[model samples]
Target chain A: MSENNNYTFVIKPKRTLWEIDLKEIWRYRDLLFLLVKRDFISVYKQTILGPVWFFIQPLLITITFTIIFGQVAKISTGGAPEILFYLTGITFWNYFSSCLTSTSNTFVSNASVFGKVYFPRLIVPLSVIISNLMKLGIQLLLLLMVWVYYIINSDAVHPQIELLLMPFYLLVFALMGLGFGLIFSALTTKYRDLTFLIAFGVQLLMYASAVIFPASVVPADKQWILFLNPLVSLMEAIKYSFLGQGIFSWFYLAYSTIFTAIILVIGVLVFNKVEKGFIDTV
Target chain B: MGNIVIKAENISKQYRLGTIGTKTLANDFKRWLYTMQGKEDPFLKIGDTNDRSQKGSSEYVWALKDINFDIEQGEVIGIIGKNGAGKSTLLKILSRVTAPTTGQITVNGRMASLLEVGTGFHPELSGRENVFLNGAIMGMTKTEIRKKFDEIVDFSGVERYIDTPVKRYSSGMYVRLAFAVAAHLEPEILIVDEVLAVGDAEFQKKCLGKMKDVSGQGRTVLFVSHNMGAIQSLCSRSIYLKHGTIQQTGETDKIINYYLSHELKTEDELNLKVNKDIPACVTQVRLLNGEDQKTKAYLSGETLRFAFNIDCQAQGNYQLGIGIASALDVNIFSEVSELMELNNGTFEIDYQNIQVKLAPGNYALTFNLLYNGKSIQYCEKVINFEVLEINRMGETYSLSKGAGFLITQGKFTIN
Candidate 1:
């Protein structure tokens, strides 16, 4: 007979998939912030430029893409400057890719800490998202400086009203990254074969996401296939609002929103099921 | 006394006993299929007990099986067991690091576990930042760590290195700082597992003192340790586990006695081959009778004899110490012989005609060979023997096992 009536929490064999325990995650909010700080500082601790790498990384990638895709390949940027066109795509794509790659290693990388202590396991991935957001902010400032240069110098550049959707774009990117990362992380713990795929899968996904070229370049008949990628519209939308190029359709953005929502829900359910016993498998 | 702060009902954990890979994926699919058809998990019905030495036929083993116990608030309970006996498994379940397979544990208040000293200390971070980071990882708030920052630094005695990166600190300093942060945590229930095994002796003493203060404040403590002395002194009650089940749960000393006698192999004679590589070593130890014949069992109140043969590679002054300890490794009596100058050779030192008033139970003999004042070679439980029932006048009576190690006859004249 159980006599204690004032128990705080009871641990069970299996919890409902939807019981995400938002309140428990809220209680560990301080830990979440601390871990975010750790991730930002530790990565650039010994490097000479430190956080400046955030800016230099996207700038370098933008220049390289412009040289390769704009000069050699002769891909049209839809009248936007080659540098600006590629930088816009690289900045947003970098954040999403980094979030996906880092968060996918959650269970494997944190197996040591996770084994010894119990906290909201979601904090690891959540911290990654927040920390990468800070990096994205820095990279956006770089984008802003370049955008101002092209705006003042050239009459062909047009800034659209849809530029106000920056926050919404960032939210969708974060959710997509977190969702895919959680699902992959859960499976990676039990089956390590997924780890090999994740390294190159993000690379292969970038071409389909319209990062280096405008989505309009795709032939009209095959455009649907490129639009099927959830990130394609979001990528094209960011470029369209900034450079006044690429297709921006309400129907495509809605598809992305709905797809991201589905992925995130399944992500949380699978993540909740795995976090309880991931230590054993990992 | 405090309405049972923690209660476990039918706690059991089953683990598959092979590499987890594609093989387990097939099993997972099978289990899923069974669940969809509204049938019980078939693998749950067949699992052997977790006995590491004996190879079992089944692929699944129960790491902990039907473990049910209620821990009251402020009670310091020690869990003692041999390696792979499910001690860590139980601690993991209690700390919520892992889930049990078929049981639920209910706790009334906040719980913190120090399964390790430094769970998440970053080498790149300074001591000051790590204190905050490690504190946060252990479930402490930023405000809480700030309030206790100065005290934690002082306790660790590494104030000068507070801003220096921890990677540069010595290993001892790291452990000291790690334990210092953990000691300041005030939770309703604290689960510690062999963390005190780290740090220097003085630091270990400080950790023990801090733990005493925690339990003194009416917060429960569940401690798992291999150090029997610490367990005996800190906890009044203990649980002894063997092969995935609780073998006994009672007083700490009695449980320790049972563990030592049953877990350790019992022998009356120890024969060791002399290795010429070592300068000096204990060769052999034996328990003898009045006729100088080797024996293991003795009646209470009889004279005990011991022989220790030692090999000395070089000539030096050697002192031998002979000790008698109870089954719990508690020293009942000991004698250190006068120092004697000896040549390089093999010699036997005999402790003969020693009066034995030990109670009826298992016991051990310890040998210490010292060069000058420092011990060159030491062996514990070199020879284990038993003290049979006491014989008084014409009758023989078995003394209660828990009645102390010494046996005495007293005059009873009631007025």
Candidate 2:
């Protein structure tokens, strides 16, 4: 008899519609954490400034948006100061975009590791979300410091009771990004056409999400177009909650939540189906 | 037999041929539509056999077809075959890295696979960091890796540069570290695939020794290798795979003999062509027994001779070389005929009975033609032959790693 505990593992073709075994994921949680740590550590290992890129990237992008949209284009912030307005948008936008791009590349980028070893395939994308969550936390603090500075120095910005809703907004953001990322990645594994389309499509998606201009400036009839996007309502609500400006409604938030939940469910189902066979096609 | 630790029931894998199989969405939709109607997958019904040469008539092929076997606890089994024989595919399915098209496998214990050494070693990570990373990727926990960290470092013999980035290490050093980490994974079942072929001869011998020690410790091992000597020496039983199906499986000597004799008998040598970049090609290779009779196999007591028929585009000073490689693809010995000896181009340059000291198991002959101090034509594993098992120097075992790669005349005493 062997010294270790006896365990039997069965491997067969995945026949079920739902192949996402939560128990397997739990068993591989340590690998998931290591993958997340690797992604976080290796990102800046060779750079002279290291993780300072995390701060500099969003800061410079926010400055460009401020100059291009607020100063030149005459877009309104709806009473919130321009710096805090764009800064808040950049924080959430950066997180959502990074999540989407990384998730979409899950099978393609990790095919080497995935092809060689046996771990829960979900560990990869979950790590993407977890590692990005750490980056988001640091970026969130940076945004808060700017928000506090504006509040202490000027009357152009103010915090409202709705600011308490920020955590819910973050959850919704994570779910939507994670869900859609899973969907795009699963599809593109079989057909490479989506890879290029996603790279271009994700950029265009930002324009529609109102990352630069305030949602209140839109014409009433066109507001429906923005609402149809699952991320738009959540982004506007996140800003309105903190800035006390723009329209904020629990109904729209709830609608976005339902939309994200449905997408996430579809994402999981598609991801499960494709992962088992995607190795061959890819 | 003891308890069955691994059982594969009716395992098979079907692959579609050509780019159209993977690149088209239309066919996938068609297949999906057929499946939704509760019918057999329409594409799976038709295909050619898994042959790489010549164009086939169908687009779908079964890579591994209905393979069934059971391994008892603590049994070390070897799987061997030529290229495209489904050996790697079978190992992949058993390791759970991929799923079979239709089959089930039950494994009764923790299993770890070393499909390739250093599979997840990041170039930027130091050797120490990669040890933890690669171990974790292979399903080892932090505590488990920590417990064996120093042993792994010691085994690799790279402790002096454990903190240096692995990218900076020489290839031999990298292989040392990678193999060291993988070897230390103390799973109940170990699956290895041709990984021991990486390091030098001494290291390979060391790895084989380590693997034998592991099996002795009561862990079941499934090994896939082309090295018949290693297989004959290490495995208690063996499986011979041909074109994605089990051709034979039984005692180690029986299966290895069957595989070698099978390969030597059926391999059509007219198709083997040397490098086209050169003006010469090796037309045929043959081995004659001591009685001057052509043979594909011989007993260890018989004299071995290599006779080659070569062709040249233009008659000139051509030096012909013959290289002998173990079944594992290691070039152990090579000899070349002098240009002065091959003046008559078409009827010359053959080596005969220099010394036949090779131990038992399969070996292959590779040829190189040097037109003037430069190798213009070369071919690897062009013609292979087996040295069947026979008593060596009064010893019962003739084929074994410890028995050595070649046989030498020695005095034996029986008092």
Candidate 3:
């Protein structure tokens, strides 16, 4: 490699939809892995509960949802145990929300680091997504415990073959969240007001995505509107595959997957272009 | 000579000069419109001159302009300039933290930049963790970092607190750890920008030694610093920048001489005028040779006479002085009229300039008119003269040492 080396590395005019040189990213994989590890360890290092906060967060949300929607409002869990149903929703929802929120603040949060070194800007957000996957894995284990208990005690529920599709759905959710997060992160580098608005927007999006309530109960008149929300379809598919009691349309699920892939492509394009000069504007 | 590892061709960076958000949006929109029209950016033409420190009509200034340079493999180059002289801007461009507004840069190998100390260090992460994080940010592989992790920890001397969060460590420790990580990482091309100024004297010495080692290993290094002593000692070649352009580039000694003689003088004089008042009621003055006792240029390490004839209305117990200041406006040496007790009977006071140990450069003189305890009048730039480099018989005395103000010889021993 050293002998045949040409001195110059040309940056050709980038006319493609996205100009990601995956080769460069692959070369920095160690840095990416280290950064991800740092993110995971540093989050709870100083806290009293440490990694327990990961479980505590979903546990607390499940309790609150059980009180407000399950008991008082008489919201149905589609014949699945309320604890199991809500924990499943909370598990997936938390991962998506964490990925989106963390990745959205990628540029602002890493500005100090970015200002000082010459690393690919993509590494920071990519690390955010990777680290949040660890959090998602922990929450999934908690949901699995609830799921196993409900299956043993109750006669109305049994795990379905659709449960095998859970990983596919999670992958879609990760890609969608990462795509939107990168877009928002790139935009927030210049217009910081978007960062302030994202928290409230994600909260509002939760109610729309059937995290606490089943998508089948959203009313037949508004069913198409619910179907239009890609996350709604993802959530419904995850629930139906595991609990066998919620709506699952292969057509809608496929549409959601395709939508996420498209969004990811567009996100990478915008992010690559914006990152080149974002330091100056930021 | 190896291939050129880095090539920068006519690169330029433009920055808006006021409050942040307002102009960026307008300029971004204008750039978008121009892109739609398939033409160059319109605001690029309307930018003011490339001087950041000066007040100008337009809010946008080019931080760098038409900067073109090439770096060969195994070359250690120093970049010297005053603050706001676009030195950092050039480094930022080379590091790819930001893109240039015009032109392109080509590089063959992976480049690592230590532009600021503790750049990627997370306050919440322990020193051990931050080392890996910072190393990664500088583009080191995991195996590479693991291989040198112990060496880095020992070099930083923060081993006791390696597992403790960096936020709990002192700032000096943090910088030491950060610099250790940066220096130990085996990048093909290393870019360091003034990060060595963070630590104490011993650490600074260690950093300089490490820099020399890096250069000796046949790696290309681009160092930016205001410390001429370090620059002179480490770099084989140097580029002197002024007003966003390359003023001179070549051997470190020659470029340093040119920078000190021409560019350093004007900035020094301007800065000196800012802090101190010129001596009072004194006309033009100059330094002269002792035999002639007339205004004449002197050489480094030569004894000469500083002659000043002040025109006065009524002669009192007035004090006259002459001082030589550095480019940063630090007074290196000064002599007062009271020391020689030259009274006002229309007399000439010629102080025998001793040691004349200043480096080859230009120096300014200020003549003062003082009555009793107050300064009645003062005139700066009373005279300006150059210190030419003298070549003795078969030997040359280089004046690059003695960094601070005056050149002195001293020895140190570590027990």
Candidate 4:
């Protein structure tokens, strides 16, 4: 009995501020995959269109932006076809928006399951991000097909070496979305007023994220204000890489990465502190 | 003895009472500031015990307080308490569903809690999918679930609907499948909280048997239930909780007996103070032992005595009745005195040495007075008392509810 020096775990009143417990999340990796599968299958179970609905949403939104902003408003697509430009922006923005919105509802949406059992609470938000990434994969295939058509006939479209950095752009979007979502999820458990604000906030953030209009269209004087969003540079970078015709600054990309890193750290810390006792408050 | 698998020290949980949202952020800010300054939470100073019936004066109340216990491996410990006694809270903390406000718990080995069944069962997902999903949520890996898939299905008895979405299945089938997945969860330490209260009696028995098997396999279990019979049948040791604190902890029988007699608020004497001016009234009723001493509890199949004082201003062909009723409000049995004439005076009536031969449970005593079958001065549920599980022979005889209260000695003949 004296050899029981190393207990499996010790539960305490307070954990260190930086203790995120990544290994615990790794242990619950199966649950994360199951939840992601649930999210994917449950949503389109009864629908006739099914997975096709995933394409319809981004395509419809892209067309709407093309007509309303590209054609009617005569907004320049930065030398790329209006459809290709808006579709690229929407595909990436959809991933981040859905990730942010869904992940932000982590505590409120999963209170029932979380209240009854114990798992790494981080798994819920992480699963949301992964599932949204899958959705983005499907939508990106749609964007690639459109790019192929434009590349065959149009001379304005340019595929460059920067296009290889697509993964980096996606990494920034996921981290930023997850970070903000975690902070909001933790706060919303107690002050549910944040739930209503999230819906309205996500919509307003899209207009500022350069999803509809190209970053070049923004006056240079106020372009610095737009870059502060951290998403603006990533959006421009994605368009510049695919079409080879928009602003893609390595410095701004680094800025967004650093910003995402800091937010992710703070977000995880807040979430860890709240997840322990949110059951009582929620 | 095996090594201690779980050790809790001074574990307490405090919850804010009333409307939590009103000024909740301000309270959080205040608590944060206090902690930043290296001081105690100012709000924690003033709070009441977790008694849900009375309105508390302070906004914060300690749902659990200073709970300390240790469980060695392979020990099945039952937590017995009334509603609002923090049994659920303690289980929640142990399960890691929630953290305690003060103090710490050291746990060695994998722990799983059945605080509820079908916790993450998706309605749109098919039963097979839900089995894997729910299993994973309970801390089983995909491979582990796959290994136990056939056994889980066979145990649930819902093999026909395994491919069907759970939302379309009947409520019973849903519960059965849910409990089936939960049963297959083989964690080193199990925390269960009244999950057997669901499903039918047969299903509850199956769950109990499964739990017994788990405990028999040398795994520690912490069980919380209001059913004393189930607790007695499964747990070797028990902890009795009352008002967020441990009242007693020891052998299951002793803790259960203490909980029934003391915590249940049994009454040995009842003062009706019936008006002396009434035609016939029961003024006082007292339960007595064989020695004519006041007692609130009795063993099964024991002789019981009762003494009552009656004030009758006018009586003609009057009848006196004593009725015993179970906790479920069912009338178990009744005995009545023969019709007789009585003059106006205060008289003492003693129904002594009556064979109880009753089952173990809480029961109420009903007294009645009637004149010429008019049913005058009838009182119901005057006093409540408990019958211990011990029988006349001093052997522990476990009696379940609805097993028939009257114990009989039937003559046996064999060919």
Candidate 5:
């Protein structure tokens, strides 16, 4: 009990937009882990299938996507098989959408705890990102199994050397989702109308980012439209590296990087500004 | 007391009264634009006092108004206030749960608040897991929790239920487990609200003893409760708050007595308001003397009179009841009109000369309307009257509080 050290904290009504103390966040890292643990464990605990439900969601979605877009609409998958193509896209898209939605609603759902106790409010959104990563890991394993089966059975698809960039690509993607989430969640505290819009907005964003269709399928004249969407390049890059079936360009990737970096800065700034006063509004 | 651990200077918090959010984004964007232009928040200038009873002219109100105080290390300071007095808001700002709208607070050491017991406890989680989770939420690391896990379990006395899910535990066990986790956290300052009110009398005493031990170790504590006796016994100093501002701060006993005697007042009649669902209600309750007229104060040894009016839409048997409470909101005695032979649709009744051997202080009256033993409406502390000091027992004010709240007759025989 006597071992703890002193901390000199001056609490005020207002602070700079970037007055984040990374050291305090570091101190509360254990809380972050426990919260992430709670998120993942609680979601699946009561269900009989438990974590197996994680694999089933994307798998079913992929099957439906393949039937509608692949067989019925006959959308070109850039010469790769339809199932593998849709699975990879859904895997990454699932991480981003789930991360963004959870982060955006952080203030609303955790209002009860926020009202009663004080913690680094950012920990909630950060843990949501981390927890969704666990589901992504499980989904990635499912994708790897399907990828492995195709590799042994056929020579139509080959893996690219850039496949090694999978983890880095996912991190950047997660950060962008987190950034957008922080902005929306903070804003939603005062104006709750955004909560309804986000659910619809994320779905609309999936179509714009080429989640089910490849950038190559869009004609060259219309290609600028795909490039304008920052996430299209990320989606193309991930698929190009994994299945060797999507468009590739460093210029667009750099453009996506800048787009993500800007949103993240805005996200952190907005999050910091909102945390102090959101309790009253919420 | 040692060096000062917490210093709050000119603290104030403004809150929007009815609605927090702007109805549309345009109104919101204009406000944000005004903020970015370095202009004063035009909206903040518009609001009334945060009194909920009266509908104010504007949407904004100041919940806390220029609160200033300094707390010394090892001092257990009691914060006493009526409801809507801003005690909770002040504690919230001190614990950093919410920032004040103005002013600054400097804290010299790490602080933890038990604003609510079992705050983040998950129903599905085991008691042990909840302890760890709750400890981590307080900023204690895994190693710190490990060092005190056994002791916390022992103190909670829930070792038998440690492995079981908290949802299965009795409400008593749940509160004990939650409090044990908070009590074990070794922050330099601890802030507690009325969390002990949930516990039974024995547990409340144990909580007070533990708080005493915490203060004994030189930890600053800010305790808030409506219980005057608890505040007097536990705190070194006391602060009285009314309408979002401090009314007084001084020695615990003096402040407690001042707070009780000052808030308590003389009254003879109470007009109770009815809520939506209650069909039967007590609209008027009056205290009287033996002459069947309204009287303000009662002599210490006098038998009190109660006259009340019960308005019921239906003519079924209705029970009009009166409850007597101390200044601290402790219920002392209660009686129903049904027992007093007031039956049926008779809207008004008078009952006289009930034995009330009470000490000299203000006591609150609560009126109730019950139909067939079911309570339809209850108004607590609607009106209070003073019992003038006659020095019947020949004891000082301090001695009277220690002996008991009431002055009853008892025959003593020495063997």
Candidate 6:
């Protein structure tokens, strides 16, 4: 027996501070796909229009912003068509907000399952983000149609080669949403007050991110404050990349990326530690 | 054994009793501050286990305290306890659904737990989709589940409804499919907790057979159940818990004996008061025992003796009798007097209890009072007793093995 123990010593079973076996997660990928598909179908399962609600939401929001801000207040769209400009901001912001809200509530919504099983908890939040991304893709297609219509009819619209960087902007927004969502998810497991705060906080964050107005409207003195909001850099970067009209500095985008990375690291650390003991408290 | 699959040392879980809210937070913080200054947590020293059941004592109960045990591969261990006895709490801790307040549990293999069947199954998802989802939740990989998909559907007997959403399936079908998926996953360690109680008798028997098969595959199992029969039949070793403490841990029969004898205490007498008068009263009751002071659990097809004392008031030739009943109040047999018996006085009766060849189960003895051979008072469930099967002679002599609690002497030949 001693010899057998010594022979098995080569396995070196030692507990690490943070040991997340990603391969085990990969093995359950089929379940992850099924969950995402279930989320997509269940959202519109009993609805009259089915997937049409996805397009209607963004279109209605764009029209509301056009009448309230564009026609009445003359909120500048920074030389881009009002419909294209508003739809772009609303479509991307909706994806981020939905992903953030859903991911933040993952633990509370799945506590029944979590209390009874021992699966990797990361799969739930990851599937939520993926499902929201599909919704974002459909909304982006509608925005692109508006962009093409303006390009053909209006000479003031100048589509720039920088528009090819749209995917990079999407990645940044997704990372920001996931990072903040994970932090809230971990905290909400203990103090459920965070759930109520997040519902209102997501709406308040849109005002600070320049989603309703052009980034150029922020005065030179107040531009530093806009830079403090990570989503502001993300929104302005996407606007400048596509419409060629807002501030597009690599320094600001780099700062946003670094901020997102740091928060993502901290979010993972907190989430890992919280998952170990949250069932007892939750 | 070369394979020591699980090793737990001094694992104790201490939960703060009472409402877990801001007040507990304040106390926890105060305790933390004192600990930093070299003082113990003051509240931990102020309570004992006996004070736990009283109202307004903060309901501060320890669910499990100072639990330590280990198991080798292929060993099946039963956790037996009453409600609020920490059986589920210990399983939850071992299954990683919750963490202990102190100590460590070292496990050498992947563990899967069916703490409750259909835990992660989405109600809107079809049975086919739920198979994968619930399997994943129980720590089975897609490839592993895919390989067993057909077998799971066949075993559940829900093949026709596989494409239908589980919310629409009958509850029996839902549980069967859920248990099927959990059983087929085949992890190194299986933890089951009271889920078998939900299924039908046939399904429960099927589940027990599957559990036996899983253990036969050289894996470890941790089973928690309140059913002493199931525990004794399935587990070689068993642990008995009482008030969050380990009362006994050893061979299954020994632990079960301790549980059945020590833990099954019932109230001796009933105290009821009407507005104007005391309608009836219990004169005397005592548990009969052998010379060893141990309650006689069984008799060898002969009469057993019980000693009783009774006092009567305002009696008009009262008839006295004793009835033997099962725990659930189904009377097995009774002896009553048809002649004049008693008056306003005290008396004692000693008789060898007659045998009706009772089965091995929990039973109760009730005494009845009658006036002029007509029943006047009935004492319900007066004293609780247990009948155990004699095990030393032969396997066929076991009362529980379809012997119908009677010894017969008829010979039969095979066709």
Task: Pick the TM-score winner.
Answer: 1
What would the TM-scores of all predictions be?
A: 0.92, 0.87, 0.82, 0.84, 0.87, 0.81
RMSD of each: 3.3, 4.6, 6.9, 6.8, 4.7, 6.9
Report lDDT (Cα) of residue B96, candidate 4.
Answer: 89
Q: Across residues B214-254, which tens digit of lDDT does each residue of candidate 2 receive?
A: 99999999999988778878899999999888999999878
Q: Per-residue lDDT of A109-183 in model 5, one digit per residue for the tens?
A: 988888888889999999999999998999999999999998888775789998988787898899999999999
Candidate 6 per-residue C-alpha lDDT over B193-299 given as tens digits, one digit per residue, 9 for 90 to 100: 87666668888888889988998998889999876667877899988888777888999877876676676764433333221232223456555544523253554
Give each model's whole-structure lDDT: 0.87, 0.81, 0.77, 0.88, 0.84, 0.75
TM-score of chain B of each: 0.85, 0.78, 0.72, 0.73, 0.78, 0.70
Docking quality level of the chain pair in candidate 2 = medium
User: What are the per-residue Cα lDDT tens digits for candidate 6 across A1-282?
Assistant: 222331121111122436666776786687688788888877886689989899999999999999998999999988888888888889888988998999898888888878887666888888998999999988888988888888789876676777788888888888788888999999898778889999999999998887888888978888988888888888887777767778887888899999999988777767776776777677
Candidate 1 lDDT over residue span A24-117, tens digit each: 8888899999999888888998899998999898889888888888999998888899999989999999999999999998999999999999
Candidates 1 and 3: which is better by TM-score?
A: 1
State in Å the error of residue A25, model 2.
1.5
TM-score of 6: 0.81
Worst 10 residues of 2 chain B by lDDT: B265-274
TM-score computed on alpha carbons, candidate 5: 0.87
* Model 2 misplaced regions, further than 4 Å: A1-7, A220-222, B20-23, B265-382, B385-415
Interface RMSD of 3: 3.1
Model 5, runs deviating above 4 Å: A1-6, B21-27, B270-293, B299-325, B329-358, B365-383, B390-415
lDDT of 4 by residue, A60-162 (tens): 9988998999889998777789999889989999999999999998999999999999999999999999999999999989999999999998998998899
DockQ for every prediction shown: 0.62, 0.59, 0.41, 0.56, 0.49, 0.32
Tens-place lDDT digits, model 1, residues B1-415: 5568889999999998888866888899999999999999988987688999999999889999999898888899999999999999999999889999998998888899999987899999889989999999999999999999999999899999999989999999999999999999988899989866667778878878888888889889999998777787789789999888999999887788778767866676899888776567778888887777888777777788877778888777788887888765578988888997877888888887555588877788887888877787777767778777745575554333556788777799989
Off by over 4 Å in 6: A1-19, B24-61, B266-353, B357-383, B387-415
Q: Write the per-residue lDDT of candidate 3 for residues B1-415, one digit (tens) a residue.
A: 5688888888877887766775668777888999899998777775566665567887778887787888898999999987878899898888877788787888877677778766677889899888887777777777888899999999889999999999999988888888888778776788888766657788888888888888888899999998776787889999988878888889997887677766543321111122223232444344566456554355566775665555444535667666775443346777666723334334555567676577755566665556675766566554556655556574443354434444455588899
Q: How accurate locally is residue B7 in candidate 2, as Cα lDDT from 0 to 100?
A: 87
CAPRI quality level assigned to candidate 3 from its DockQ score: acceptable
